[model samples]
Target: MDFSTMIGHDTIKNQIVNSIKGNRFSHALIVTGENGIGKSLIAKEIAIRLLGKAEEKQYVDIVEFKMSKDKKSIGIDEIKSIIQETTKKPYEGDRKVIILYKADGMTEAAQNAFLKTIEEPPRGIFIILLCEKLENILDTIKSRCQVYKLNRLSEEEMLKFLNNKFESLSEDELKAVSAFSDGIPGRAERFLEDKSLMEIRDTVIDILKGICEGKLDKTLLYTEFLLKYRGEWQEVLTYFLSYIRDTLIYKETGNKELIINIDKINEIKDIAEMFSFNKLNGIINIIKDTRSKLERNVNATLVFDSMLVKIQEV
Candidate 1:
């Protein structure tokens, strides 16, 4: 995809294009943003641009390295492999590009091992590191790179892009998908085809409702059901976060205009009233932290159980 195809982060795109055009591109570049905010897309675009387009059955010589979720870090061996690849001459383009997705997941040792290459990067090689957290990286490493921060897209921009791209969708379809996308274009795309996500979201909302009504045991049934989809815990938490955010909005504004869960406004109101603002905030923090830890490979059942027990106290 071209840089223009990216939904947001215009400033970053322009900066990168200017850098490439001026032959002043940084050897080390870090792209940081929240999940669903197009960091990976940007990284891929930059890589393709650097590598240039390739013909059929021809190798463009671009290397992509993703941090392993199971390992919770980029291994030293992988870094060594990247270094070896970087040492080679470009196969098809003027420069060889290496895109590292989830560089923040790199272990301390891996980061240290990578520093040598960063300090004296190979000629004609451009390295792009994509991450969500900048603090997780060493300061010396960050100092050697140009760091670009990506923010969430505005609702107007998000809606416009969705309407333009999904022209055949109904108004309700657009609204529903837009709300669930939460101002992220990549997420909006996923929401378009994800028929099962709404059902899972409904289940989460039902669990929250049961808790608010003092039917705490009902969460156990939902929790069991959630575990059945082992790989979907992240998606489940994302929906849960959106559900709580909608409830909080309804509570604060008392305006249906801002409510996304229109069909379940009553339930949102009930939960919003049952918990104090501080309690709700704390629960949200807990969910966010639990979700992060879950991404780092914490057991799903254990995480959900702990979250349930903690939320019950509120």
Candidate 2:
């Protein structure tokens, strides 16, 4: 895919294009961001463009590796095999591109094994490390590469994309999609993939309604329902947060256009009026903190329980 096809991060795309155009390509580069933010897509696009080919198969010089699903980490042997592969000359071009997906999944030993090769990369060797977390990678590995921390798309950008993709989408649908996207284009696109996602969002709104309205029994039941789908806690948390955020925005600004959950304007209005402005911040923080913990692989039940208790305080 070309850079134009990839939504968001126009600045980063231009920077990469310019660097390659000027022949100032770095031997190693790190593309770090949350999943669904298009890091891997951008990396492949960069590799293809830099290799002077639009077709992936035509770029014989490019090699890619994803984290081995059979193991907890990328073993030292895997890294060594890649290092060995990098030693060979390009088959069709002067430059050989090494695309390592989820590079942070590399074991400590694998990272050490990779140090020498990345430190003094051979002629025509270009390495791209795509990772979700910068902290998981070693400083030695990080220092040797140009690090690009990608950001999410803006509300306008996301809305524009949704509008372009679904011509018949209503204003409320557009608003919900744009707001729930959390700046990730892929997350926004998932609305098109999964039909039940919006249903889940509506249920989350019901749980919030129960809690905010002091309907403890219903809220407790809703919480149980939420935990039943514990596997989707991440998606649940996202919609929950987005709904609350939209309500907060409406409460604070009194601007309907600024809110994301347009279809649930009545619900948002009712919920927003139930609490004062100060209470909203605390609730937002509680949910945001819970999301961070969940992202770090904490126990889902414990995190959700803790989050509910804290939110109840508001």
Candidate 3:
């Protein structure tokens, strides 16, 4: 998609345009930002602009490599394959571009193997690495590229885009989705297309209330039931954390505006009374920690079940 269709990141788009206009486009470029902040989207645009060819005609020269779906890391073999293919001339475009998503997930061997290629990149070759954190990438690699970070969209910008795109939502609904999107347009779009996200969010809120009411058996039972959905554990964890966060925030500040589960403020405030401030913080930390562990290829069921049991401590 083009910049006009993108929700925000106006400054990033300007920088890209200016860099190309000034003939300062780097052979190695890194676009780093949090998920759903449009780093990959911008990278694709940069590739297309630099190619100076139509997307359909030059599709052969645009290689997209990513971490394996079932694996945590990109292996050295994959990088070697890229190196072999990139050594050849472009099929149609002026340049051969490799869009490497999740490049930070590359193993040490792969990263070391990649250094030589990027250090002295071949003429008419562009490598773009999209990442969530700069620290995860090698310093030598970072030094070889022009790095640009995309900033989170303001709540106002996210809300404005949501309001303009979706005609059905009321002001409250718009505010709710925008806040729940957490400064990300792609997330807001997901919420708009799938109403069930809100439905599942409410169900998790109910489960949190069940826990607060000392119905531990019932709450864990619900968690087990929800865990049957193979890929939705993250979604469950997200809303659960949102509920716990809202409880802690509201408990500490007595502020409705800070809560993210906008549809059930009263229920959240009621649950807020069940925990001491320290206990609330403990639970929040546990959930956050579990999330981080899950990203490192940890067992989902164990992490989630342990999280449920640990919340009982508070």
* TM-scores of the candidates in the order shown: 0.80, 0.85, 0.84
Which segments of candidate 1 are over 4 A away from where they belong?
52-59, 68-70, 228-238, 244-255, 265-303, 306-314
Off by over 4 Å in 2: 56-59, 70-72, 212-217, 223-225, 228-232, 249-255, 273-282, 295-297
lDDT of 2 by residue, 1-314 (tens): 57876668899999999999999978999999988888988888888887888675546687898876767688798898889988999988788899998899998889999999998888989999999889999999999999999998888878777777777888887777776777887887886678777678878888778788776555666667777778777888778777778888898898998877777889999989986777778888888898789779998777877777777776
Give every collision pair in model 1: none
In model 2, how large is the Cα lDDT of residue 20?
Answer: 93
Score each candidate by Cα lDDT.
0.80, 0.83, 0.80
The order of the candidates by lDDT, greatest first, is 2, 3, 1
lDDT of 3: 0.80
Q: Count clashing pairs, candidate 2.
A: 0
Report the alpha-carbon TM-score of model 3 versus the true structure: 0.84
On TM-score, the leading prediction is: 2
The alpha-carbon root-mean-square deviation between model 1 and the true structure, to one decimal in Å, is 3.7
What is the descending TM-score order?
2, 3, 1
Q: Per-residue lDDT for 226-259 in model 1, tens only?
A: 7876577877887778778887888788898777
Give the winner by lDDT.
2
Of 1 and 3, the candidate ranking higher by TM-score: 3
